[model samples]
Target: MSICSYLWCLIISLSCVAPLSGNPAAVKEQISLKREKTITNIVNGVPTIDKKFFARINMPYRDKVCGGVVIDRWWVLTAARCVDHVSDHQYELRNVFIEIGNFTTGSQQKKTYKAKAIVIHPMYNLTTNSHDIALIKLVKRAPMFRVAELCSEPVEYGTEVGACGLGSTPARHPSPSASLHEIFLRGIFFSFASFFEIDFCPDDQVCTEPITDGASICNLDEGSPLYKLQCHSRAAECILGIASHFVASEHSEINCSGGSNFASVPHPYEWISETIVFDFLFNSGHLDRSF
Candidate 1:
């Protein structure tokens, strides 16, 4: 990708707030202080996702900033941008870990796993935000965490969906929430998005706006999952989209006050299935490869 393309990619990050400073020490200190203050406010009192199906993506150099959902005992699906770093080559992120079975960011009891490998969609383009999905392999299986089932059903316009993440709340804070926070968003059609001057990517992407006021995904975990509850059972949730970019409204450049786009997991169902299956077979010694 050209420098211009790369710059466009940065816009897709959790860029609702100012970008992190160059000094690693300063960034780390800021994260620590932010964690200390998170308990005082829970980001609009949004409840955290259940401990069983949620995961927090943390960097060794930075605090937890991204979110992911468990796909199986060994795999997680998140936005490619969350773990993407300019300094690293594709399919590799340094010192990335995920915390599972932990609801609070300050908790000491979460099961953390070092990432074994990372894979981004082969067709993912930074310029157009196409195929913005990524898969992560953990060094060990997290059998205790509940797996999220993939859904292939097409999403209709105006469907109510739920999104959760460790992202910060709008209007009140720039730091991420200490605990997971969730909000309900009603899906919107891509065509309608243009009328409101919102960025809507319908090709392999889904868009949503907050159902409540003063709620925007602004700086939430980049790879948080968007869920569609099963029609018959409230207990079951089908993974629909992986959070990618939050578009700022024309009036404000600092917040995703208008809407956000997620890479549609179901839209590229074949890619997701093939990627997961290939990894599974290779790891189990059923497939041979020369690398």
Candidate 2:
């Protein structure tokens, strides 16, 4: 017999015998193990390692009251409502602090920075929750922390996204979670904003539904960054939006079960870039005070 023909016959014989020789229960167990390993990487209200771009916004006597993402060395992007103080006139600049590089709320290794300024969107409306975005200028540049890149592309319906924050969970009511938690959510078409008693523009907001039951962004999760993995790698996160508010549902008693909306990063991309440049110039005394 030829060498090629002999090898082909041997391969066919092994293929036929391998399945017969394999134990059914063992094969099933191996398949189950493989599935479990794959599911482990998918976020489902699980604790996450410390992310350099994740920012915890803390108020006086409160830890991680809101969440933010570092967009620049001295700037953090967040929801306008998180630091809104229209009546108080910039009170958050003094009271709010930014904590970075910490997974837990009270970690000693966390770096805290005082806020130099809190800039809310000019068109932000308290009644309708429109233009719900803001920026926080840090007192000094955040060192050793990576800046999250803002995503310009629109999130297509059914696309998977990730959200991370130190927010309230079922076990921790009336208080934020002690450690950072991440959950996977899918972009959805949410047209019934009025029915849910939430206001959002489809063009400027990204609506999402949780992939895992009982896993959602809850209280104190406002301003938490909604990101997508770049190149399917956990290390490369592209910020898509910031958590704005939860859509209340009359059918469900659970918080954030109905779904949530985020202020799209690309919607305010121009404003953000301009504001940063203007702030830098003004603070550096390059711009005329009279002008």
Highest lDDT: give the candidate number.
Answer: 2
Candidate 1 colliding pairs, count:
1
- State candidate 2's TM-score: 0.73
* lDDT tens digits, residue span 1-291, model 2: 999999988775444221222354553333233221110011237777746788888887434378899999989999888777523334545678888886755567778888877778887775666778988888889874568888876644456778888765552253567888888776643333323333334567777665676566766788889886543354435888888876543333443444567788877888888888887767752222112
Q: Model 1, residue 58: displacement in angstroms? A: 1.6
Off by over 4 Å in 1: 1-45, 49-51, 62-64, 86-94, 189-199, 231-236, 251-253, 284-291
lDDT digits (tens) for residues 22-55 of candidate 1:
3535533322332221110113337564636788
Clashing residue pairs in candidate 2 are none
Q: Tell me model 1's lDDT, rounded to 2 decimals.
A: 0.64
**Range of the 10 consecutive residues with the lowest summed lDDT in candidate 1:** 34-43
Clashes of each: 1, 0
Residue 39's C-alpha lDDT in candidate 2?
5
